[model samples]
Target: MRTVFIFMNEASQAVEIPKDMQFEAVAELEIRREGDTVLLRPVRPNWVSFAHEPTASADFLAERPCVLKTDYFDLSGAGESSEEPGQ
Candidate 1:
């Protein structure tokens, strides 16, 4: 079986790859979504989870506003953060 890791967002997958394209060596896929459409790309599967972190400092945050999310999350209700309903 081919192991595929996908980042879930807004009750949909952020990344999806065809079964045929998923080879033994290929474990990870990258995707960026606009509404319901998904654009698939190649990535390092092993480090997908590792990439989910706040890379900006306080100065950076002041310059640009952004929201951070974690890997391996639920979208139907509360997200990975066990705090609120929409967060």
Candidate 2:
């Protein structure tokens, strides 16, 4: 909706940013060229995606109970003691 002129390798050229655009004093942006058009977009921080509250309930841990006992088998000596019929 806004138009801005960007000059390449021109130090004297000045670009005016719209006042409605809100940003911090210092910000990072990404520029890309698609065909003949150029696109500019803000580079968000990595943590921004995880900034919101989780959709799952907070009592999720309490719903799943832990089992104290587990079953395991020992197969180390099973095949070692068995011999071939020809032997």
Candidate 3:
């Protein structure tokens, strides 16, 4: 509902988001357009990107055995149900 300015940055278009609306400590934003509306979203970090990085921290990449504080559900029989051979 807030009004924002849309201007050109060299060749591509850019929007100047207000400081109050800006995402804290974020260097990038994920932009997507649907129909006539343009959406701006904060780019949250995921483990896949970290795992693929060449210089991740040793503690993060280390094979440290972890103890589960709470019980975890067993997935041993997850997909053993009867199905077609090619399925």
Candidate 4:
């Protein structure tokens, strides 16, 4: 099956996922704080112009077809990316 991956960035990373594409839990969101700066990094991520607002994700699924995945890293150990739901 074909897949379309979407990555989130610091600017819009805080936006809530659409209701249709809502998953049991959100994948881990990586945030880094240093001194007085904060950085938000997405797992590694688009827009569907033709889809209706409510059905955008469903439409996207129909077209390219994809499974939502969340990538996460273990900070305590090594920052290794993992495919497990929330990592």
TM-score of each: 0.24, 0.34, 0.55, 0.19
Q: Where is model 2 more than 4 Å wrong at Cα?
A: 5-14, 22-26, 46-87
Model 3 lDDT tens row, 35-75: 99998888877998678778857688477667665457877
- Please give the range of 10 consecutive residues that has the lowest summed lDDT in model 3: 61-70
Of 1 and 2, the candidate ahead on TM-score is 2
lDDT of 2: 0.68
Error of 2 at 84 (Å): 21
Backbone clash count, each prediction separately: 0, 0, 0, 2
Kindly report which residue pairs in candidate 3 clash with one another. Answer: none
Model 2, C-alpha of 23: deviation from truth (Å): 3.6
Q: Each model's C-alpha lDDT?
A: 0.64, 0.68, 0.82, 0.55
Report the lDDT tens digits of candidate 1 across residue range 9-75.
9897544557776556656666688998656666753566568855776576566555676655766
Q: Over the stretch 1-87, how does candidate 4's per-residue lDDT look in tens digits?
A: 333345677666444556675554547556789998666555333245235355445556456645655455545756565666575
**In candidate 1, which residue ranges exceed 4 Å CA deviation?**
1-18, 44-87
lDDT of 4: 0.55
lDDT of 2 at 46: 69
